[model samples]
Target chain A: MKKLLIALLVSTFSFSAMADGHAEWWKKAGAPYAGTVIQGVAENTPPGQFAGEVLAKDFEKLTGIKVQLENTSWDQMYDKAIKDMEANSGIYDFVYIEQDIVYSYLDRDFLVNITQSLKDQPELVAPMVNMDDFTTFIDYFKDGSGDVFGMPMEAFVKVYLYRKDLFGAADAKSGFQKKYGYPLAPATSFAQWRDNAEFFTGYCAEKGMECWGTTVQGHTGHPASTYEFLESIGPSFGLYNWGVTDDFHSCVEGGGSLNGARAKAALTFWTSMLEFAPPESLQSTWSEVASTFAAGRAAQGWVYGENAAWIASNEEKSVVVGNVGVMQPPTAPGVMTQAAAGEGYIGYFDGGAYGIPHSSKNKEATLLWLQYIAQSEVQADWAVAGARITHYSTYDDPKVAAMDQIADGYFTLMQNTGYLYAGAPMYPFHAAGRAAIDPFTYAALAGEMSPSDALDGACEALDKVMKDLGYQN
Target chain B: MNSSKTAWLLLSPTIVILIIVGLLPFLYVLYVGFFNWMPLGKNKEMEFINFGYNYRELVFDKFFIDSVWRSIRFAIVTLALELTLGFLLALSLLSSFPLKAFFRSVHTLPLVIAPIVVGAIFKLFLVQGLGPIPFLAKELFGFKLNYMSSEAQAFWTIVVMDVWHWTPFVTLTLLAGLSALPQDPYESAKIDGANNFQIFIYITIPMLVPVLIVVIFIRMMDSLKIVDEVWMLTAGGPGYSTRFTGIHIWKEVFEKRTYGYGSAMSVLYLYITIVICWILYSVMVSRGKANEDE
Candidate 1:
């Protein structure tokens, strides 16, 4: 009975204190929506898991609203969110909007305009939830007329991660120099990347180390293959957004350059890298690629920033905990200059936001939830947990700054060169376009089709789809 | 009159459910197959058009045709292997033997597991480097087997997993049929001084025709709808080499959200399945009737 009394006292004191701060504003503004149940659908990524399982608890405590965050796989997340919104079922109040799919969602008018929403109800906007604090990733979810449609939650870029220990070894460095007549370091160009892959793969084989030169996400039959090609590899080779032209044509007959010489060359180079990757490369996705590198079976690979922190610091899960290095992906001759000039992207800038669906029954409640997540104070803990941060202020936080050493300069690289980043194209038919390319890309990886042929086939299909969708004459 | 009215009342709920759940949605699918319906796009409402558009697009679609062919080929391969292996296992278990009941129980275990679970289990077992099966193959045979990577190997791997999981079901069905066979024909054949092999061929083979037909019919239907294993395993890739029609339709409907095209494909698939089933039934029945007459 004494313990129970203490628990009740603590709860009362905490609520009274919380009801005094910025949360006090929420406690007042959320008077009508309190105790209402709202739900969100999100993938099982680091940031998503933290938001769903951890932050949702704090959100309910602060606002007296119940939140159910359904954490699931990527496929199921998309299926459930899209199906519910399309059916106008009002099942989900908030949906995680991937950076790549922002175009599709905005084009469909499926998301509520948060800027307009906040304007209409100024009281609902908490002082701590300032939109100006977010990074430029917020632009990915904005309309042409400058209406903000979503709150940027997580933002990350793909980087070339290498084994510092292997590169720093005296013997390996001297041997690489002897064989390739260059210093062994992180690759700065595609040619150098290939050379390093070859040298390391052969060296590992000679030593019977069971390690490969690099890892590739070249799953022969999944959408990951298409993603790796269009987002990561093609951008480095100076072909962006599957090489679709401004008018959205993808074939020569339609006056587009999707199957142009540069694209074919990029596809060729990407497929060639598969030879030096592990045998599992043919069946590996991003998750497997990360695992392969973390297992110390690969010397270097382009892995998502989300995995960098855990792979570099978590000893129980990763073998090369301390010996990790990060850098921007290698670019072709003039591509780096263009990318640096902000004319194009050199690598994949991947992230997502949370937006309220128009079909949501609890729009006001969901808005409060979004605002709660948008606070800069909540960002530091989320960044530490997920290795993702969208608020520019979170970068200055001492705790987040300390993660640089463990993440091997991941944040530093992202800060220094993140402007030269890109993501999926602004296409409403994004999924359809990917479906058209995935088969041929997988076939190319499997050596069933030549790179040029695969590009030709993919573009031809895309052209037909574009015409069918009335994108072109 | 009271009894007839009671029977009508009893059937009304089932009729209502069928109309609500089954028939209505089916009609809706047919209606949506014409024109464009972008549920989440600027065109939130449906735009009606002539039916020729969806059909024309599908008719020339090489990808759709390839998926259909792949599904049929997988169905045929699985059916052939399951029938042969199932028949052999059933024949062997016909004789009284040690631990017969234990073997029977063990053989039925795979049938109890879900197809998706089987797929997930084999996905792990077939991982290129870390999987135990690949590790053992390398250690024992001095050769590598990358099942889920190579095109032919992945396709055959899925087939092998299915055969392993479902062949026991066929064996059980055949075993029950074999147990129920009459013994008078075999006795007369033995009394006429025919050898054991002749008696078995003339009596057992002729008597099991009806049971074999039933088993084949059931197996054909199930194997043709092979979606879960492939979806879990390769997802019809390395270049659509294993993409059956069902996966194609699923991607179209769910991933691409091309409901109009997907519904058209569904209708076409339904028609094709019905035609093929009818043909198979006619052939099998005619063959059985001819054998019985002979």
Candidate 2:
């Protein structure tokens, strides 16, 4: 009887605590729109843990709509989004999707179509959200036909995160030019970038200093980071600049095969430089990469812009936060490839976009949620507080502008330089292709197979896939 | 009539479960295997292709053939290792020892943990650079051992992890078989002054053959269809060094979105598993019949 009482007391207290956590969003309306919204985000940050408080208090006070945010890790959020959408689980009212999986949702029509949804909820979209600012963003998704699919929320981006102290140690300016006939500044092309990283990291490693020059994400399964790294280096080679001539009617899709000399050469240049990365990079998974970079192990980590927020929060790991450099990714040593005239990589595919599922019964409410988030005010606030990349006409808020990291005009640099690769959307089934590449490609590099043989083997396997799907002409 | 009614009622749930969970899905996979399919129905161009194309490609594709070979190799390697380790463990465990019950329960720990869990733990321990196993290798042995990064090492590491997880299964089964052995032959051998090794080889060996054959058969059948561990640990990676048929088929199902193609690959995989298992079963059964006649 005594034991039962103790157990009962514990259960009651825990249950009430959970209820308070969940129901805190159900506050009395002091504003026009006074309902609670269930928002889901990845567990990487604290917003989700303190969801009932942070989002609810600010959101309700500002918009009169109470937001109930549930946080799970970024990886869990990606998996859950798929399951919830496929099964029409609706467990989450508004899920926070990792930017990488946005394409999966876009391809499957599992997310809310914010472009259309914004029309219905003017109160949500009113003076705060600027439609005019999203012209570039809209035209990015608009193919020949002017249909828009997604509204950008947050972006995980690559900045040439280098060490200033290293720069400080060396004869910073004139010494670099004398050593390598180039100006000592942020690398504008892929070739110079590679050479610099190799020079520093490789040279350091040889000296038995335990420190290498450069690092980035290259986990066996973390393809997203790998793709990002490849793209950063790709542009300097003019790789992403070329598309299979947009005249699809005249040409076969993916006409520019990965097996092409240019692609292989680009990959070779990329792979050969692995000597500069940490030995443990092969096992450094996504979180490990972030923490490693935060731990400041590598001299330069291919880092995301949002890492600024993370660096700010975690004091123990980051030694030089204000001194940390932020800019567009470096070019490969010899990649002079420019985007065919207008075929620029304006939007790299790494931002969250809303999509409406066919299974959704409450499309209106869902649309309202989408429009509300896409508003300029929200986008600006997301940048300042959420520390997220805004898709709304670039936020002009002084709060975001004051960020010393972005003060070097990195956003502007990327805005001007970045390209939207006309690559196939990263759908779920791309997993097979991803799975196939690692073992065979690495083997090729390791002298098991020639590059041509690797391509042939991989292509033949893919051909079988095509044939299995009856995709032969 | 009442007895018959009771039997039918008692057996109905199993029958229903078999249909719902097993037979129907198995048959459906076979049906889906006959055509081209997409998950979201967007690729109208790829909609109606026949199964003939799939068969032709599978027959021709070297990667598919290689993947099949890998899966078969994996199963054979794991089975041999499991039986050897398990048999030895069974011998030791058959006798009473300190903490016998606790140790026996510990032997089944891997069995209780999910295959995915085993994969995760091993991945953490075996992953190149970050894993502790490599640290131990470098510090203690002074070897540049990459259990996962290198192709051959990746395959061997997976095999070793599997052996660790599954050998206990064989041991527990073999222990049970050893425990069930009759004492008459041992008693006669003891009276005749037959030594331990000689008596064991002549008496315990032939008697436990049937149970061992059955155990081998069961383990072989399950090992061939293993997807979760291979997928979780490596996803057949370090450049397809670990790419098994299980990884191939699952990729088709989840990543490729070609449900029909995935179904077809699964059907082909299933066919191979069944044929191999059937051959083993036939040998075991015929051996049993021969023993019975003897």
Best candidate, DockQ-wise? 1
DockQ of 2: 0.38
| Model 1 ranges off by over 4 Å | A1-20, B1-8, B38-45, B195-197
- DockQ, per model, reads 0.51, 0.38
- Between which residue pairs do clashes occur in model 1? A220-B238, A221-B237
The digit string of per-residue lDDT tens for model 1 on A1-473 reads: 99999998998788568546776787787788878999899887878888988788888887888899998877788989988887889999999999888888887778999989988988787886778899898899899988889888889999999999888989899999999898999898889889889988998999899888888899887788789888998888888777788877887666666788778888999899887898888888887888899899899998988888888877888999999898888888788888878777788999999999999999988999998999887898788777887988888877788887788878878777889988788888888778878889988998889999999999988876666566656
Estimated TM-score per prediction? 0.94, 0.82
RMSD of model 1 against the true structure: 4.9
Per-residue lDDT, model 2, residue B270, is 79
Best by TM-score: 1
Say which docking band candidate 1 falls in.
Answer: medium
Superposition error at A472 for model 1 (Å): 1.3
